[model samples]
Target: MEEHGTTQPGDGTTLVPGPGSAFRRTLLRRMLPAVAAAGLGITGIAGVAHGAAGGPQRTAAADFPTWGTRWVVHADADTRSPAVGMVNASAPGKDRITADYQVDTGRRVCEGSSCSSYMAHLTGPVSGFLTVVAVAIPQDRLPGIPVQGAPPPQPGVSRQEMLARAATWLTADNGAQVSYSQAKVWKDGYRQDCSGYVSMALRLPTPGTNTVGLATDRGLTRPVPLGELKGGDLLIDATGDNNRHVVIFEKWNDAAHSSYTAFEQRGGHGTDHRSLTYGLPGGDAEFTPYRPVAFSD
Candidate 1:
C-alpha cells in the first residue's frame, strides 16, 4: 500500500524485526501448535469489512435546538451527515461515522462528559472533527474544525471495495499514520495497526480484534487451502502473545503458486502492498491463510 520512513520501538534500523529476532523465532517455534490447533498448515497459506446508528433529522441551521448542538467525527468525510441519514449518508461507503458535538467539545455545556469519555463512544480512531453552532454563530468565533471528506461506511462492504479503499489510503493521507504501538497517526490522529488496517478496509465496527482474534473471529471460518485462496483472503500468524501479523491476499504470481501479493500495515511503515515470496525475507513457515465464513469459492 505504501512505503514510508518510520520505525517502531526497540528496533530502529529495520521496518520489521528480522527473521532472527526473538519475537519472530519464538512465534515460529510455537507455530506448530497454533497451526496444528488451527488444523491447516503444511507449507503455505493466506486469507482476507460495518454499520452506524440512526438518530434524528438534520436540524437545519435554523432549527438546531438552542440548548444543544450536533457534531460528527469519523476518519472518512463522505459518509458524514447532520442526522444519521440526512447528509452524505448513502450506499457504497460503509465506515461508521457519528458524533455528538455537545459531548466531545465542551460545547452546549453538557453536564458530565470529557474528551476521554467521549472517545470511548467513537467507532474507530479520531479521524475527523466537526462542530456546528445552534444559532447563526460566526465560523471564526468557533474553533477551526476542518471538514474532512471520506466515503460513507456501508452496512457491508465488498472485497473489491475493501481493496480499493486500502489502495487509496496506502498512498493518501490516512495511510501509514499509525505503524508503531505508542505512536498516533502521523503524529496526532487516528492510527491503524495491521488489524486496524483490515478493520478499516473491511468497514468493521470493532477495532480491538488483532491478528489472533481475526484468525479465529466468529465472522470468519478456519484457514482455507492455498488452491482456493481468493483476492480478499488473509495470511495471518497468531502464535506469540503480542507478536502477530495479518496481510490481505491480493493474488499469486508463480509457476508453483508458492508466492503471492498482499496488503499490510507494518511497524516501520503505515500501509503497503507486498509480495509474500517463499524462502525470501518476508517468507516464513509460521503464517496461516484464512477466509471470511461467508466467502464462497
Candidate 2:
C-alpha cells in the first residue's frame, strides 16, 4: 500500500481526515492501513489504487469497460457540465466544451493504416450527471478514416420504419433532445448532423456518409418533383461543403402542398421534426426533393 495524503479510486488506500487540520496528516499515516484492511471508504477523498510493486496502476476511467457498455462522464466536479471530453452535446456556438468520451472498450480509432486512440461514442446531444443522453465516444478526428467503411444500407427499410427511427430522437425518453454537432457521432454510430440523422432514419451504415453522398449517390436517392415527395423522401441542397444541408420529408403539411413537415438535424438544434418550406414556391430554391432508392415506391 502506497502512503499518500489522498489516493485515486480503487487503489485500496485513502485519506482519513481528522478534526484538526494538523491532525489529519498525522492521523492518516497511522490509520491508513487499518482503514484499508477494514475496507473503509470515506467520502470526499480522492482514492488512488495501484498493483503490487512492479505492477500496473489503473485509473478509474481506464478500468471502465469500453465497447458496447455505455458510460457517463462529467465536465466538472459538481457534475453540472455533461458536455465535455471526446463527446460534446453542446449546441453550435455554445461555450460548453468537453473531451470526456464514451469509448468502445477494446476497439481503437484508426486512420488508414495508422491507428491511435480508442474511438468515442455518444448517447445524446447534451446531458446531466444522471441523464443518459445520446452515447458519444471519442472521435479523434471528424471524417475519421474509419477502420471499415459503413456497412451496406439495410435493405427494404420502410418509410414508416424510417419515420419511427427519426421519431426516436424527438421523444423525451430518447434524450428529450439531441444537440447539434458536426464533429461528434451519436451512440447509434451516425454523424450528428442533418445528413447523419437522415442516414440513421434510412438505416444506413454507421458513421454515415456526408450530405453530398446522400444527395448525389444515384444508388441512394433519386431526384423527385416536390409534389411527388412522400413520407420518407428528402429535400437536400448538395451544392457545396459550406452550403449543403438535408431534411427527411415526413408528410405534406396541407393538401395544397404549400408546406410540409420534416425531420431535420441542423446547427444549434440537434434533431427536430417540424414544418418546412425549403422546396416550396418562394422558398429556398437550393433544395431539391428526392426519394431514397431503398423505398419500394
Candidate 3:
C-alpha cells in the first residue's frame, strides 16, 4: 500500500477519531434520520419515497444485484465550507471533491460461497456520512473491471464449489497478519487487521484513489450505518466498547437470520456477524459500502 498526502487542519481537513470519540457519536446522531429516510428504518423517519417529479420511480427488487462492480459517490463539488470540519469551526470556501473507489474481493478462494472477511475503507470520510446532507452514488451507477487473467470457468460450479476454493486461499496459514493498534505498521507492512482485512477483501487499494479507507485515512469524515449493508461492505464497531473489530458482509440469510452473523479467519478468532446489527446491546456497528476493484457483470 502506498502512502497518500495528509490533509492539514487548516486545509479544512479533520482527523477521523478512533471509535468511541464524541465526534463519531455526534455524527451518527445526525445521520440516523437520513438513513431512516432512505428506507432502511432508523426510527422517526419514513421509508424511501417512491416518486420523482413526473412519475413513479422504478425500484430495484429485493433480489436485484445488491452487489456491483465499481461504486462512485460525488459531493457538491461546488459547496463552500466543509459541513464537518476537523476542528471547532466550519471549513472555508467552495472546495468541491470527488472520489472513485475499487472494492477489494479479499481472497478468490471464497467466491460465491458462504464465508466471512472484513471490509474497511467504505466506512471512511469519502464514503461515510457525517451529516445526512452529503451526496452519494450507488454501485448500480459505477461498474468495476471484468475478471481477468483466468479464462471463463466450465459449465457450472455451484456457489458452493466456488466458495470452497476461495476459502482455501483465505484460511491458508500464511504469515500475513494485521493489527489495529498501529496504523503506521499497516502503512509500512501493507498487511491488514480486522478492519484492513475487510478493506483488502473488497480489493480496495492503497490510497491515491477515491477508495473509502484511504479517504478516511486522508481525513474525509462521516458516521456509517449497518442496515444499508451489501456484499463487499464494511462493518465497524466504532464505540470501541465492544471488541473493536471490522468485518465484511459476505451473505445475508433471511431465514432465522439474527441481527448478526459470525466471522472466522485464518489466524483471527471467530467474531459474531450480528455484532453489526443496528440498535444492539453494547453499541451499534457502523457500516459503509465499497466498490469492487475486480467485479464484473
Candidate 4:
C-alpha cells in the first residue's frame, strides 16, 4: 500500500478552531457518543486497562486532556490516506452502515503512518459500537524498497550533515525506503506518515509498535504514573483522533516539575528533541505515554 495525505475537502489544518465552529461542535458530538459507547460511563472518569487473564479491571484514565502532546491541524491533503482494516467502515467485504459512525477504541498499533489511516477509518461515521485491536509489526519483517544512489559528499559537513547522514543510512541505504508513485525512489516511506520516520530513527520494527499492544505484549501493561516518566521513554497520543502524536522523552526538568527535551517529527521534520513546552501545542494535541522497546535496554 502507498502512503499519501488526506484529500477531504474543507478540512484545513489548524491546531484549534474559533469558538462555535461547526467542526468543533461536530467533533465533540461524535466523540461523546463514541466515548460513551466505549463504556466510559461518565466524563472525567478513569478507564480500566484489561488484564492478561481477566477482563477489564478498573483503572483511572490519566488527567491529561485533549489529543496529542502537540499537533497541527493538517490540511486534508497532508493527512495520511485511509486504509480499511477488519474494523473500518470501508473494510473489504463488509457492509456499510449509514447512521453508525466509527469511534476509536484506543486499541492501536504503529504500522508507520498507516496507523493514522486505521485510526481515522475506524473513527469515521458509524452508528453501532466497533471494537479495535492493536497489533504491532516486528522490525525484521519490514518490506524492502529501492532508494536513491549516493550523492557526492559536501566539503566541511556540520551537525546537520551528520543527522541527515544518519537518516539516509537508516532509511534510504538500509533497505528502508517505501514505494512512492511520484518519485523514482523515496525514503522515509511507509503505510503511515510518521511510522517510517520513527521506525528508522529508533531502529525499531517497521510499521512500528502498537502503543496498547506493546504494553501488553511486552509485559508493561500496568498503567504508569505520570511522575514515573524517564528520559528515552515514549509518550504516545493514542486517542485515535487526528490529534495523535508521539515523543521520546529526553529528561525531566525538576525546576518546572515537567519533563523536558523530547523528540518528535512535526511539520515535515525529522525526529529531534525540544522543550516539553514546545512539544505541547495550544490545541488538538492528545497524548499517552509508552516506553519504546529500544529504550528498555
RMSD of each: 19.1, 17.3, 19.6, 18.9
lDDT of each: 0.41, 0.51, 0.28, 0.32
**What lDDT is reached at residue 191 by model 4?**
20
Prediction 4 global C-alpha lDDT:
0.32
Instruction: Put down candidate 1 lDDT per residue, 78-167, tens digits, no spaces.
Output: 212222211122221122333322123222211112011121122222334322221112111111111112122431246787678567
TM-score of 2: 0.51
Task: Compute each candidate's TM-score over C-alphas.
Answer: 0.47, 0.51, 0.29, 0.33
**Can you tell me which runs of candidate 3 are displaced by over 4 Å?**
1-169, 174-189, 206-225, 255-257, 260-297
lDDT of 4 by residue, 76-144 (tens): 212232323222223321332121111222233221232221111122232222221111111111122
Off by over 4 Å in 4: 1-192, 207-223, 268-270, 277-285, 293-297
Cα lDDT tens digits, model 3, 44-132, are: 11111222334323222110011111112213221122332211112321222222221222321111211111111122324421211
Rank by TM-score (best first) = 2, 1, 4, 3
Score candidate 1 by lDDT: 0.41
Give one clash count per candidate, in the order shown.
24, 37, 38, 25
**Tens digit per residue, CA lDDT, model 2, 1-297:** 111123224532222111223343234333333232122111111122312233223322211111111223334222223434322212311222121223222323221222222332322332322111111123232122222122334733799899889888775324676667664555454667787788778876544667888888898999988788989899998885347899988889888988999988889767888889987898888898899999988
